[model samples]
Target: MEKLRIVFMGTPDFAVGILDTIYNSQFEIAAVITAPDKPAGRGQKVSVSAVKTYALEKNLPILQPTNLKNEEFLAELASYNANLQIVVAFRMLPEVVWKMPKLGTFNLHASLLPNYRGAAPINWAIINGETETGVTTFFIDDKIDTGAMILNKKIAIDSNENVGQLHDKLMHLGSETVIETLELIEKGNVTTTIQTENSELKTAYKLNKDNCKIDWTKSGIEIYNQIRGLCPYPAAWTYIKDGENEWNVKIYDSKYIEEAHTYSIGTIISGKKEMKIAVANGFIQIESLQFPGKNKMQIHELLNGTQISSEAFVK
Candidate 1:
Protein backbone atom coordinates (compact mmCIF):
# COMPACT_ATOMS: atom_id res chain seq x y z
CA MET A 1 0.00 0.00 0.00
CA GLU A 2 1.19 3.54 -0.71
CA LYS A 3 2.12 5.68 2.30
CA LEU A 4 -1.05 7.75 2.82
CA ARG A 5 -0.56 11.50 2.82
CA ILE A 6 -3.24 12.71 5.25
CA VAL A 7 -4.51 16.11 6.38
CA PHE A 8 -6.28 16.22 9.75
CA MET A 9 -8.96 18.75 10.70
CA GLY A 10 -10.22 19.15 14.24
CA THR A 11 -10.36 21.35 17.36
CA PRO A 12 -10.84 20.86 21.13
CA ASP A 13 -9.41 18.21 23.46
CA PHE A 14 -11.72 15.51 22.18
CA ALA A 15 -10.16 15.84 18.72
CA VAL A 16 -6.59 15.90 20.00
CA GLY A 17 -6.19 12.18 20.69
CA ILE A 18 -7.32 11.12 17.21
CA LEU A 19 -5.02 13.65 15.54
CA ASP A 20 -2.14 12.45 17.71
CA THR A 21 -2.86 8.84 16.76
CA ILE A 22 -2.67 9.67 13.07
CA TYR A 23 0.47 11.74 13.61
CA ASN A 24 2.22 8.80 15.28
CA SER A 25 1.06 6.29 12.71
CA GLN A 26 3.07 5.20 9.67
CA PHE A 27 0.88 7.38 7.46
CA GLU A 28 2.31 10.79 6.57
CA ILE A 29 0.42 13.77 8.07
CA ALA A 30 0.66 16.49 5.40
CA ALA A 31 -0.89 19.17 7.60
CA VAL A 32 -3.35 19.91 10.41
CA ILE A 33 -6.31 22.30 10.21
CA THR A 34 -7.73 23.67 13.47
CA ALA A 35 -9.75 26.63 14.60
CA PRO A 36 -8.15 30.04 14.86
CA ASP A 37 -6.98 31.36 18.24
CA LYS A 38 -9.52 33.39 20.17
CA PRO A 39 -9.64 35.21 23.53
CA ALA A 40 -10.99 33.13 26.40
CA GLY A 41 -11.61 33.28 30.17
CA ARG A 42 -12.22 36.30 32.39
CA GLY A 43 -8.93 37.90 31.42
CA GLN A 44 -9.70 37.24 27.74
CA LYS A 45 -6.22 35.94 26.96
CA VAL A 46 -5.79 34.52 23.46
CA SER A 47 -6.35 30.77 23.59
CA VAL A 48 -5.34 28.20 20.97
CA SER A 49 -7.27 25.02 20.35
CA ALA A 50 -6.03 21.77 21.86
CA VAL A 51 -5.27 20.35 18.40
CA LYS A 52 -3.27 23.45 17.49
CA THR A 53 -1.28 23.25 20.73
CA TYR A 54 -0.40 19.61 20.10
CA ALA A 55 0.46 20.28 16.47
CA LEU A 56 2.84 23.05 17.55
CA GLU A 57 4.59 20.71 20.01
CA LYS A 58 5.07 18.09 17.28
CA ASN A 59 6.15 20.77 14.77
CA LEU A 60 3.50 19.65 12.32
CA PRO A 61 2.26 22.03 9.61
CA ILE A 62 -0.85 23.82 10.96
CA LEU A 63 -3.58 25.85 9.30
CA GLN A 64 -6.07 28.08 11.13
CA PRO A 65 -8.66 29.28 8.66
CA THR A 66 -11.33 31.68 9.83
CA ASN A 67 -13.28 31.04 6.67
CA LEU A 68 -13.30 27.61 4.99
CA LYS A 69 -14.38 28.98 1.62
CA ASN A 70 -11.77 31.73 1.38
CA GLU A 71 -9.71 31.43 -1.79
CA GLU A 72 -6.44 31.85 0.07
CA PHE A 73 -7.36 29.24 2.71
CA LEU A 74 -8.67 26.83 0.10
CA ALA A 75 -5.54 27.26 -2.02
CA GLU A 76 -3.29 26.63 0.99
CA LEU A 77 -5.28 23.52 1.92
CA ALA A 78 -5.11 22.12 -1.62
CA SER A 79 -1.34 22.70 -1.71
CA TYR A 80 -0.84 19.97 0.94
CA ASN A 81 -1.38 17.28 -1.76
CA ALA A 82 -3.05 15.09 0.88
CA ASN A 83 -4.58 11.84 -0.31
CA LEU A 84 -7.08 11.67 2.57
CA GLN A 85 -8.58 14.29 4.91
CA ILE A 86 -9.65 13.26 8.41
CA VAL A 87 -12.01 15.41 10.45
CA VAL A 88 -12.81 15.01 14.14
CA ALA A 89 -14.77 17.41 16.33
CA PHE A 90 -14.56 20.14 13.66
CA ARG A 91 -17.12 22.45 12.13
CA MET A 92 -19.26 21.50 9.14
CA LEU A 93 -17.16 21.54 6.00
CA PRO A 94 -18.04 22.97 2.62
CA GLU A 95 -18.34 20.56 -0.32
CA VAL A 96 -15.30 22.13 -1.98
CA VAL A 97 -13.13 21.34 1.05
CA TRP A 98 -14.35 17.79 1.79
CA LYS A 99 -14.17 16.92 -1.89
CA MET A 100 -10.67 18.31 -2.45
CA PRO A 101 -8.71 15.28 -1.32
CA LYS A 102 -8.32 12.23 -3.60
CA LEU A 103 -9.77 9.99 -0.86
CA GLY A 104 -12.84 11.91 0.37
CA THR A 105 -12.81 13.47 3.84
CA PHE A 106 -14.12 11.35 6.71
CA ASN A 107 -15.30 12.30 10.21
CA LEU A 108 -15.22 10.41 13.48
CA HIS A 109 -18.54 10.96 15.18
CA ALA A 110 -19.04 10.28 18.92
CA SER A 111 -22.27 8.37 18.43
CA LEU A 112 -23.41 5.73 15.95
CA LEU A 113 -24.58 7.27 12.69
CA PRO A 114 -28.35 7.67 11.94
CA ASN A 115 -28.79 8.23 15.69
CA TYR A 116 -27.59 11.14 17.79
CA ARG A 117 -26.45 12.60 14.44
CA GLY A 118 -25.60 16.13 15.53
CA ALA A 119 -23.45 17.99 18.01
CA ALA A 120 -23.37 17.08 21.73
CA PRO A 121 -23.89 13.36 21.07
CA ILE A 122 -22.16 12.24 24.25
CA ASN A 123 -24.28 14.55 26.41
CA TRP A 124 -27.53 13.71 24.67
CA ALA A 125 -27.03 9.92 24.80
CA ILE A 126 -26.69 9.92 28.58
CA ILE A 127 -29.40 12.54 29.05
CA ASN A 128 -31.82 10.39 27.08
CA GLY A 129 -31.15 7.45 29.47
CA GLU A 130 -29.51 5.30 26.82
CA THR A 131 -27.68 2.23 28.06
CA GLU A 132 -25.42 1.97 25.05
CA THR A 133 -23.68 4.32 22.63
CA GLY A 134 -20.83 4.05 20.14
CA VAL A 135 -18.58 5.87 17.70
CA THR A 136 -18.59 5.88 13.89
CA THR A 137 -16.31 6.87 11.02
CA PHE A 138 -18.06 8.03 7.87
CA PHE A 139 -17.31 9.86 4.63
CA ILE A 140 -18.42 13.51 4.66
CA ASP A 141 -21.56 14.21 2.65
CA ASP A 142 -23.42 17.39 1.69
CA LYS A 143 -25.70 17.10 4.77
CA ILE A 144 -24.27 16.88 8.24
CA ASP A 145 -23.69 13.32 9.55
CA THR A 146 -25.59 11.82 6.62
CA GLY A 147 -22.54 10.21 5.12
CA ALA A 148 -21.72 6.61 4.23
CA MET A 149 -20.38 4.70 7.22
CA ILE A 150 -16.94 3.13 7.04
CA LEU A 151 -17.01 1.43 10.46
CA ASN A 152 -18.51 1.60 13.97
CA LYS A 153 -17.53 0.30 17.41
CA LYS A 154 -20.09 -0.18 20.16
CA ILE A 155 -19.60 0.91 23.78
CA ALA A 156 -21.74 0.27 26.83
CA ILE A 157 -22.55 3.19 29.09
CA ASP A 158 -22.25 2.73 32.83
CA SER A 159 -25.34 3.42 34.89
CA ASN A 160 -23.87 6.47 36.62
CA GLU A 161 -21.41 7.58 33.94
CA ASN A 162 -21.47 11.27 33.02
CA VAL A 163 -20.52 12.98 29.76
CA GLY A 164 -17.01 13.72 31.08
CA GLN A 165 -16.21 10.04 31.56
CA LEU A 166 -17.98 9.02 28.37
CA HIS A 167 -16.24 11.78 26.47
CA ASP A 168 -12.80 10.44 27.35
CA LYS A 169 -13.83 6.87 26.62
CA LEU A 170 -15.12 7.75 23.17
CA MET A 171 -12.18 10.01 22.44
CA HIS A 172 -9.76 7.14 22.83
CA LEU A 173 -12.11 4.72 21.09
CA GLY A 174 -12.46 7.12 18.17
CA SER A 175 -8.69 7.25 17.74
CA GLU A 176 -8.48 3.48 17.37
CA THR A 177 -11.37 3.51 14.90
CA VAL A 178 -9.74 6.23 12.86
CA ILE A 179 -6.57 4.18 12.60
CA GLU A 180 -8.56 1.13 11.54
CA THR A 181 -10.50 3.11 8.95
CA LEU A 182 -7.28 4.53 7.52
CA GLU A 183 -5.84 1.04 7.19
CA LEU A 184 -8.91 -0.05 5.25
CA ILE A 185 -8.63 2.90 2.90
CA GLU A 186 -4.89 2.35 2.37
CA LYS A 187 -5.46 -1.33 1.45
CA GLY A 188 -8.38 -0.47 -0.87
CA ASN A 189 -10.66 -2.62 1.35
CA VAL A 190 -13.17 0.10 2.22
CA THR A 191 -16.82 -0.96 2.17
CA THR A 192 -19.11 1.98 2.78
CA THR A 193 -22.56 1.34 4.27
CA ILE A 194 -25.51 3.67 3.80
CA GLN A 195 -27.26 4.74 6.97
CA THR A 196 -31.00 4.10 7.17
CA GLU A 197 -33.72 5.84 9.16
CA ASN A 198 -34.69 4.61 12.59
CA SER A 199 -38.15 4.99 14.04
CA GLU A 200 -36.76 6.12 17.39
CA LEU A 201 -34.14 8.41 15.92
CA LYS A 202 -33.12 11.01 18.49
CA THR A 203 -30.96 13.92 17.34
CA ALA A 204 -28.37 15.48 19.66
CA TYR A 205 -28.48 19.15 18.80
CA LYS A 206 -26.54 21.83 20.65
CA LEU A 207 -27.18 22.34 24.35
CA ASN A 208 -28.62 25.62 25.61
CA LYS A 209 -29.41 27.02 29.08
CA ASP A 210 -33.07 26.09 28.71
CA ASN A 211 -32.29 22.43 27.95
CA CYS A 212 -29.61 22.24 30.63
CA LYS A 213 -31.89 23.45 33.44
CA ILE A 214 -32.95 20.76 35.90
CA ASP A 215 -36.63 19.97 35.77
CA TRP A 216 -37.50 18.68 39.23
CA THR A 217 -41.01 17.82 38.06
CA LYS A 218 -39.64 14.88 36.09
CA SER A 219 -39.27 11.39 37.58
CA GLY A 220 -36.32 10.71 39.81
CA ILE A 221 -34.68 8.37 37.29
CA GLU A 222 -35.16 10.83 34.42
CA ILE A 223 -33.75 13.69 36.46
CA TYR A 224 -30.84 11.50 37.50
CA ASN A 225 -29.98 10.75 33.87
CA GLN A 226 -30.20 14.41 32.91
CA ILE A 227 -27.95 15.43 35.79
CA ARG A 228 -25.29 12.86 34.93
CA GLY A 229 -25.41 13.65 31.23
CA LEU A 230 -24.45 17.29 31.69
CA CYS A 231 -22.14 17.00 34.70
CA PRO A 232 -18.70 18.71 34.86
CA TYR A 233 -19.22 21.07 31.93
CA PRO A 234 -22.22 23.24 31.32
CA ALA A 235 -23.65 21.41 34.31
CA ALA A 236 -27.31 20.85 35.04
CA TRP A 237 -28.56 23.87 36.93
CA THR A 238 -31.50 25.09 38.97
CA TYR A 239 -32.51 28.32 40.63
CA ILE A 240 -32.09 28.42 44.38
CA LYS A 241 -34.35 30.99 46.03
CA ASP A 242 -33.57 32.38 49.48
CA GLY A 243 -36.13 35.04 50.51
CA GLU A 244 -35.82 37.79 47.89
CA ASN A 245 -32.58 36.47 46.29
CA GLU A 246 -32.67 33.85 43.57
CA TRP A 247 -29.75 32.55 41.56
CA ASN A 248 -28.57 29.58 39.53
CA VAL A 249 -26.50 26.78 41.04
CA LYS A 250 -24.80 24.12 38.95
CA ILE A 251 -25.36 20.50 40.06
CA TYR A 252 -22.49 18.17 39.08
CA ASP A 253 -23.10 14.90 40.88
CA SER A 254 -26.27 13.45 42.45
CA LYS A 255 -27.77 10.21 43.71
CA TYR A 256 -31.37 9.28 43.09
CA ILE A 257 -33.66 8.19 45.96
CA GLU A 258 -36.41 5.91 44.64
CA GLU A 259 -38.68 5.75 47.66
CA ALA A 260 -42.11 7.32 47.79
CA HIS A 261 -42.13 10.99 48.74
CA THR A 262 -44.91 13.46 49.45
CA TYR A 263 -42.70 16.53 49.26
CA SER A 264 -43.48 18.86 46.39
CA ILE A 265 -41.13 18.89 43.40
CA GLY A 266 -38.10 21.23 43.68
CA THR A 267 -38.18 21.19 47.47
CA ILE A 268 -34.80 21.50 49.09
CA ILE A 269 -34.40 18.86 51.81
CA SER A 270 -31.22 19.25 53.77
CA GLY A 271 -29.37 17.89 56.77
CA LYS A 272 -26.24 19.16 58.48
CA LYS A 273 -24.00 17.93 55.64
CA GLU A 274 -26.44 16.57 53.09
CA MET A 275 -28.64 18.21 50.46
CA LYS A 276 -31.40 16.62 48.41
CA ILE A 277 -33.88 17.98 45.91
CA ALA A 278 -37.38 16.54 45.79
CA VAL A 279 -38.43 15.40 42.33
CA ALA A 280 -41.56 13.67 41.00
CA ASN A 281 -41.18 10.26 42.70
CA GLY A 282 -38.36 10.86 45.18
CA PHE A 283 -35.27 13.00 45.81
CA ILE A 284 -31.86 13.56 44.22
CA GLN A 285 -29.10 13.70 46.81
CA ILE A 286 -26.69 16.37 45.75
CA GLU A 287 -23.14 15.06 45.69
CA SER A 288 -21.23 17.99 44.19
CA LEU A 289 -22.31 21.48 43.18
CA GLN A 290 -21.09 24.98 42.36
CA PHE A 291 -22.47 28.38 43.15
CA PRO A 292 -21.84 31.52 41.15
CA GLY A 293 -18.38 33.03 41.79
CA LYS A 294 -17.46 29.97 43.86
CA ASN A 295 -15.44 26.91 42.99
CA LYS A 296 -17.14 23.53 42.80
CA MET A 297 -17.56 21.87 46.20
CA GLN A 298 -18.97 18.81 47.86
CA ILE A 299 -22.51 18.99 49.19
CA HIS A 300 -21.21 19.14 52.76
CA GLU A 301 -18.78 21.92 51.93
CA LEU A 302 -21.46 23.93 50.11
CA LEU A 303 -23.80 23.52 53.07
CA ASN A 304 -21.22 25.10 55.37
CA GLY A 305 -20.56 28.06 53.07
CA THR A 306 -24.10 28.84 51.88
CA GLN A 307 -27.38 29.47 53.63
CA ILE A 308 -29.97 27.01 52.21
CA SER A 309 -33.06 27.82 54.20
CA SER A 310 -35.91 25.38 54.79
CA GLU A 311 -38.05 27.22 52.25
CA ALA A 312 -35.35 27.02 49.60
CA PHE A 313 -36.58 25.38 46.41
CA VAL A 314 -35.27 24.94 42.86
CA LYS A 315 -37.06 27.13 40.35
Candidate 2:
Protein backbone atom coordinates (compact mmCIF):
# COMPACT_ATOMS: atom_id res chain seq x y z
CA MET A 1 0.00 0.00 0.00
CA GLU A 2 1.23 3.50 -0.80
CA LYS A 3 1.92 5.61 2.29
CA LEU A 4 -0.69 8.38 2.54
CA ARG A 5 0.66 11.93 2.84
CA ILE A 6 -1.08 13.39 5.91
CA VAL A 7 -1.42 17.00 7.05
CA PHE A 8 -2.30 16.95 10.76
CA MET A 9 -4.16 19.88 12.31
CA GLY A 10 -4.61 20.11 16.10
CA THR A 11 -3.86 22.23 19.16
CA PRO A 12 -4.27 20.52 22.56
CA ASP A 13 -2.68 17.63 24.46
CA PHE A 14 -5.40 15.33 23.19
CA ALA A 15 -4.26 16.07 19.62
CA VAL A 16 -0.64 15.48 20.60
CA GLY A 17 -1.36 11.84 21.41
CA ILE A 18 -2.80 11.19 17.93
CA LEU A 19 0.10 13.00 16.29
CA ASP A 20 2.56 10.88 18.24
CA THR A 21 0.83 7.69 17.10
CA ILE A 22 0.91 8.77 13.45
CA TYR A 23 4.54 9.81 13.81
CA ASN A 24 5.47 6.35 15.03
CA SER A 25 3.21 4.54 12.56
CA GLN A 26 3.72 3.64 8.89
CA PHE A 27 2.01 6.79 7.55
CA GLU A 28 3.94 9.74 6.13
CA ILE A 29 3.23 13.12 7.76
CA ALA A 30 3.81 15.95 5.31
CA ALA A 31 3.16 18.78 7.75
CA VAL A 32 1.48 19.78 11.00
CA ILE A 33 -0.93 22.71 11.31
CA THR A 34 -1.52 24.05 14.84
CA ALA A 35 -2.66 27.17 16.63
CA PRO A 36 -0.18 30.01 17.00
CA ASP A 37 1.65 30.55 20.28
CA LYS A 38 0.05 33.06 22.62
CA PRO A 39 0.80 34.56 26.02
CA ALA A 40 -0.47 32.54 28.98
CA GLY A 41 -0.15 32.37 32.80
CA ARG A 42 0.73 35.10 35.22
CA GLY A 43 4.02 35.88 33.52
CA GLN A 44 2.22 36.28 30.20
CA LYS A 45 5.05 34.48 28.41
CA VAL A 46 4.40 33.20 24.91
CA SER A 47 3.42 29.55 25.01
CA VAL A 48 3.33 27.12 22.13
CA SER A 49 0.32 24.87 21.70
CA ALA A 50 0.72 21.30 22.95
CA VAL A 51 0.53 19.89 19.41
CA LYS A 52 3.01 22.47 18.09
CA THR A 53 5.46 21.72 20.90
CA TYR A 54 5.45 18.01 20.11
CA ALA A 55 5.69 18.63 16.36
CA LEU A 56 8.66 20.92 16.86
CA GLU A 57 10.46 18.36 19.01
CA LYS A 58 9.95 15.74 16.30
CA ASN A 59 11.25 18.14 13.60
CA LEU A 60 7.93 18.10 11.74
CA PRO A 61 7.16 21.04 9.46
CA ILE A 62 4.64 23.30 11.24
CA LEU A 63 2.10 25.85 9.96
CA GLN A 64 0.45 28.46 12.20
CA PRO A 65 -2.06 30.39 10.17
CA THR A 66 -4.22 32.94 11.97
CA ASN A 67 -6.89 32.54 9.32
CA LEU A 68 -7.50 29.19 7.65
CA LYS A 69 -9.20 30.85 4.63
CA ASN A 70 -6.29 33.12 3.81
CA GLU A 71 -5.33 32.64 0.16
CA GLU A 72 -1.61 32.55 0.97
CA PHE A 73 -2.07 30.00 3.74
CA LEU A 74 -4.34 27.86 1.60
CA ALA A 75 -1.87 28.00 -1.26
CA GLU A 76 0.96 27.07 1.09
CA LEU A 77 -1.10 24.18 2.44
CA ALA A 78 -1.83 22.93 -1.06
CA SER A 79 1.90 23.01 -1.83
CA TYR A 80 2.42 20.03 0.47
CA ASN A 81 0.29 17.89 -1.87
CA ALA A 82 -1.02 15.90 1.05
CA ASN A 83 -3.39 13.04 0.34
CA LEU A 84 -5.44 13.70 3.48
CA GLN A 85 -5.77 15.99 6.49
CA ILE A 86 -6.46 14.91 10.09
CA VAL A 87 -8.05 17.27 12.59
CA VAL A 88 -8.13 16.80 16.39
CA ALA A 89 -9.18 19.36 18.98
CA PHE A 90 -8.68 22.19 16.46
CA ARG A 91 -10.88 25.07 15.48
CA MET A 92 -13.54 24.60 12.81
CA LEU A 93 -12.19 24.62 9.25
CA PRO A 94 -13.68 26.32 6.24
CA GLU A 95 -14.88 24.28 3.28
CA VAL A 96 -11.97 25.58 1.22
CA VAL A 97 -9.47 23.89 3.54
CA TRP A 98 -11.36 20.67 4.28
CA LYS A 99 -11.98 20.15 0.56
CA MET A 100 -8.35 20.77 -0.36
CA PRO A 101 -7.08 17.27 0.39
CA LYS A 102 -7.80 14.54 -2.11
CA LEU A 103 -8.73 11.85 0.40
CA GLY A 104 -10.78 14.39 2.36
CA THR A 105 -10.13 15.79 5.87
CA PHE A 106 -11.08 13.63 8.83
CA ASN A 107 -11.64 14.81 12.42
CA LEU A 108 -11.01 12.74 15.55
CA HIS A 109 -13.79 13.69 17.92
CA ALA A 110 -13.72 12.85 21.66
CA SER A 111 -17.30 11.66 21.91
CA LEU A 112 -19.53 9.41 19.79
CA LEU A 113 -20.82 11.27 16.75
CA PRO A 114 -24.17 13.15 16.86
CA ASN A 115 -23.68 13.50 20.64
CA TYR A 116 -21.47 15.86 22.56
CA ARG A 117 -20.49 17.33 19.18
CA GLY A 118 -19.52 20.80 20.28
CA ALA A 119 -16.39 21.68 22.25
CA ALA A 120 -16.05 20.13 25.70
CA PRO A 121 -17.03 16.53 25.17
CA ILE A 122 -15.12 15.01 28.05
CA ASN A 123 -16.52 17.56 30.47
CA TRP A 124 -20.05 17.38 29.16
CA ALA A 125 -20.18 13.59 29.36
CA ILE A 126 -19.13 13.68 32.99
CA ILE A 127 -21.51 16.53 33.77
CA ASN A 128 -24.45 14.68 32.25
CA GLY A 129 -23.54 11.53 34.21
CA GLU A 130 -23.15 9.42 31.10
CA THR A 131 -22.30 5.78 31.64
CA GLU A 132 -20.42 5.50 28.35
CA THR A 133 -18.66 7.76 25.87
CA GLY A 134 -16.31 7.15 22.96
CA VAL A 135 -14.25 8.63 20.20
CA THR A 136 -15.19 8.90 16.51
CA THR A 137 -13.27 9.46 13.31
CA PHE A 138 -15.46 11.27 10.78
CA PHE A 139 -15.20 13.18 7.54
CA ILE A 140 -15.14 16.98 7.94
CA ASP A 141 -18.14 18.61 6.28
CA ASP A 142 -19.79 22.03 6.21
CA LYS A 143 -21.33 21.39 9.63
CA ILE A 144 -19.47 21.04 12.91
CA ASP A 145 -19.08 17.41 14.01
CA THR A 146 -22.08 16.54 11.81
CA GLY A 147 -20.05 14.66 9.20
CA ALA A 148 -20.32 11.02 8.22
CA MET A 149 -18.49 8.72 10.57
CA ILE A 150 -15.56 6.63 9.38
CA LEU A 151 -14.97 4.77 12.64
CA ASN A 152 -16.06 4.81 16.32
CA LYS A 153 -14.87 2.99 19.45
CA LYS A 154 -16.98 3.13 22.58
CA ILE A 155 -15.61 3.09 26.15
CA ALA A 156 -17.43 2.89 29.45
CA ILE A 157 -17.48 5.92 31.74
CA ASP A 158 -16.93 4.98 35.37
CA SER A 159 -19.38 6.33 37.91
CA ASN A 160 -16.64 8.09 39.88
CA GLU A 161 -14.48 9.13 36.94
CA ASN A 162 -13.71 12.84 36.82
CA VAL A 163 -13.02 14.92 33.73
CA GLY A 164 -9.26 14.63 34.20
CA GLN A 165 -9.36 10.84 34.29
CA LEU A 166 -11.87 10.56 31.46
CA HIS A 167 -9.79 12.94 29.35
CA ASP A 168 -6.73 10.68 29.58
CA LYS A 169 -8.86 7.68 28.71
CA LEU A 170 -10.32 9.28 25.56
CA MET A 171 -6.95 10.74 24.59
CA HIS A 172 -5.34 7.30 24.30
CA LEU A 173 -8.43 5.70 22.82
CA GLY A 174 -8.72 8.45 20.19
CA SER A 175 -5.05 8.04 19.22
CA GLU A 176 -5.50 4.37 18.40
CA THR A 177 -8.81 5.03 16.61
CA VAL A 178 -7.19 7.68 14.41
CA ILE A 179 -4.37 5.31 13.49
CA GLU A 180 -6.83 2.52 12.64
CA THR A 181 -8.95 4.88 10.56
CA LEU A 182 -5.89 5.94 8.61
CA GLU A 183 -4.90 2.33 7.96
CA LEU A 184 -8.38 1.54 6.63
CA ILE A 185 -8.24 4.63 4.41
CA GLU A 186 -4.90 3.56 2.99
CA LYS A 187 -6.35 0.16 2.07
CA GLY A 188 -9.24 1.74 0.10
CA ASN A 189 -11.69 -0.23 2.24
CA VAL A 190 -12.96 2.58 4.47
CA THR A 191 -16.71 2.93 4.95
CA THR A 192 -18.57 6.04 6.05
CA THR A 193 -21.79 5.87 8.08
CA ILE A 194 -24.19 8.73 8.61
CA GLN A 195 -24.82 9.83 12.17
CA THR A 196 -28.08 8.77 13.84
CA GLU A 197 -31.24 10.14 12.19
CA ASN A 198 -32.79 11.16 15.53
CA SER A 199 -33.26 14.88 16.08
CA GLU A 200 -32.39 14.85 19.80
CA LEU A 201 -28.64 15.23 19.29
CA LYS A 202 -26.76 16.15 22.47
CA THR A 203 -24.30 18.99 22.11
CA ALA A 204 -21.02 19.57 23.92
CA TYR A 205 -21.29 23.30 23.81
CA LYS A 206 -18.32 25.45 24.78
CA LEU A 207 -18.00 25.86 28.58
CA ASN A 208 -18.03 29.40 29.84
CA LYS A 209 -17.61 31.22 33.15
CA ASP A 210 -21.33 31.42 33.83
CA ASN A 211 -21.93 27.69 33.58
CA CYS A 212 -18.99 26.90 35.84
CA LYS A 213 -20.65 28.42 38.86
CA ILE A 214 -22.09 25.88 41.24
CA ASP A 215 -25.82 26.07 41.83
CA TRP A 216 -26.54 24.61 45.24
CA THR A 217 -30.24 24.36 44.49
CA LYS A 218 -29.52 21.39 42.21
CA SER A 219 -29.62 17.79 43.39
CA GLY A 220 -26.60 16.24 45.11
CA ILE A 221 -25.76 14.17 42.07
CA GLU A 222 -26.01 17.13 39.74
CA ILE A 223 -23.75 19.27 41.88
CA TYR A 224 -21.34 16.41 42.36
CA ASN A 225 -21.11 15.70 38.66
CA GLN A 226 -20.72 19.35 37.80
CA ILE A 227 -17.85 19.76 40.23
CA ARG A 228 -16.09 16.68 38.91
CA GLY A 229 -16.65 17.71 35.31
CA LEU A 230 -14.93 21.04 35.83
CA CYS A 231 -12.30 19.92 38.29
CA PRO A 232 -8.59 20.75 37.81
CA TYR A 233 -9.40 23.25 35.03
CA PRO A 234 -12.14 25.80 34.81
CA ALA A 235 -13.17 24.49 38.20
CA ALA A 236 -16.74 24.74 39.43
CA TRP A 237 -16.91 27.48 42.01
CA THR A 238 -19.30 28.88 44.61
CA TYR A 239 -19.32 32.01 46.68
CA ILE A 240 -18.97 31.92 50.45
CA LYS A 241 -20.09 34.81 52.55
CA ASP A 242 -18.27 35.53 55.79
CA GLY A 243 -19.75 38.60 57.44
CA GLU A 244 -19.03 41.47 55.04
CA ASN A 245 -16.40 39.57 53.01
CA GLU A 246 -17.27 37.22 50.18
CA TRP A 247 -14.86 34.48 49.07
CA ASN A 248 -14.93 32.44 45.87
CA VAL A 249 -14.06 28.81 46.46
CA LYS A 250 -13.16 26.42 43.68
CA ILE A 251 -14.14 22.82 44.33
CA TYR A 252 -11.50 20.48 42.90
CA ASP A 253 -12.70 17.12 44.17
CA SER A 254 -15.60 15.78 46.23
CA LYS A 255 -17.60 12.75 47.14
CA TYR A 256 -21.33 12.26 47.68
CA ILE A 257 -22.22 11.01 51.15
CA GLU A 258 -25.57 9.23 51.42
CA GLU A 259 -26.05 10.06 55.08
CA ALA A 260 -29.05 12.16 56.05
CA HIS A 261 -28.56 15.86 56.48
CA THR A 262 -30.44 18.47 58.51
CA TYR A 263 -28.89 21.54 56.89
CA SER A 264 -30.67 23.36 54.10
CA ILE A 265 -29.30 23.70 50.58
CA GLY A 266 -26.04 25.69 50.27
CA THR A 267 -25.13 25.22 53.92
CA ILE A 268 -21.56 24.37 54.81
CA ILE A 269 -21.16 21.26 56.96
CA SER A 270 -17.93 20.27 58.62
CA GLY A 271 -16.54 17.38 60.62
CA LYS A 272 -13.34 16.74 62.48
CA LYS A 273 -11.71 15.29 59.37
CA GLU A 274 -13.85 16.44 56.41
CA MET A 275 -15.57 19.52 55.05
CA LYS A 276 -18.90 19.02 53.32
CA ILE A 277 -21.65 21.21 51.95
CA ALA A 278 -25.33 20.36 51.98
CA VAL A 279 -27.01 20.34 48.58
CA ALA A 280 -30.65 19.86 47.69
CA ASN A 281 -30.72 16.13 48.40
CA GLY A 282 -27.48 15.02 50.07
CA PHE A 283 -24.07 16.23 51.18
CA ILE A 284 -20.91 16.65 49.12
CA GLN A 285 -17.75 16.18 51.16
CA ILE A 286 -15.07 18.35 49.63
CA GLU A 287 -11.79 16.49 49.40
CA SER A 288 -9.94 19.18 47.54
CA LEU A 289 -10.55 22.89 47.04
CA GLN A 290 -8.90 26.25 46.41
CA PHE A 291 -9.47 29.81 47.48
CA PRO A 292 -9.63 32.70 45.08
CA GLY A 293 -5.90 33.48 45.22
CA LYS A 294 -4.42 30.20 46.41
CA ASN A 295 -3.42 27.00 44.64
CA LYS A 296 -5.51 23.85 44.88
CA MET A 297 -4.93 21.99 48.13
CA GLN A 298 -6.49 19.24 50.13
CA ILE A 299 -9.17 20.28 52.60
CA HIS A 300 -7.26 18.79 55.50
CA GLU A 301 -4.07 20.65 54.64
CA LEU A 302 -5.90 23.91 54.06
CA LEU A 303 -7.63 23.62 57.39
CA ASN A 304 -4.41 22.88 59.27
CA GLY A 305 -2.53 25.78 57.72
CA THR A 306 -5.40 28.28 57.62
CA GLN A 307 -8.24 28.74 60.04
CA ILE A 308 -11.78 28.39 58.60
CA SER A 309 -14.24 29.17 61.35
CA SER A 310 -17.12 26.73 61.42
CA GLU A 311 -19.51 29.63 61.67
CA ALA A 312 -18.56 30.77 58.16
CA PHE A 313 -21.03 29.73 55.47
CA VAL A 314 -20.51 28.93 51.79
CA LYS A 315 -23.09 30.61 49.62
Q: In model 1, which runs have C-alpha deviations exceeding 4 angstroms?
A: none
Q: Which window of 10 residues has the lowest lDDT sum in candidate 1? A: 301-310
**For candidate 2, lDDT tens digit of each residue in 1-315?**
656999999998989988999999988999999999899999999999999999989999999999999999999999999989999999999999999988999999999988999999999999999999999999999989999999999999998988989999998999899989998999988999998857787889899988999888888899889999997788999898756778888898999976677787777766556788887677889999998888888998887876656666776
lDDT of 1: 0.92
For residue 155, give model 2's deviation from the true position in Å: 0.4
State the TM-score for model 2. 0.97
Model 2 alpha-carbon miss at residue 8, Å: 0.2
Give the distance in Å from residue 271's predicted Cα in candidate 2 to where it truly belongs: 3.7
Top TM-score hit: 1
lDDT, residue 201, candidate 2? 77
Assess every candidate by TM-score. 0.98, 0.97
Give model 1's clash tally: 0
In model 2, the worst 10-residue window by lDDT is 306-315
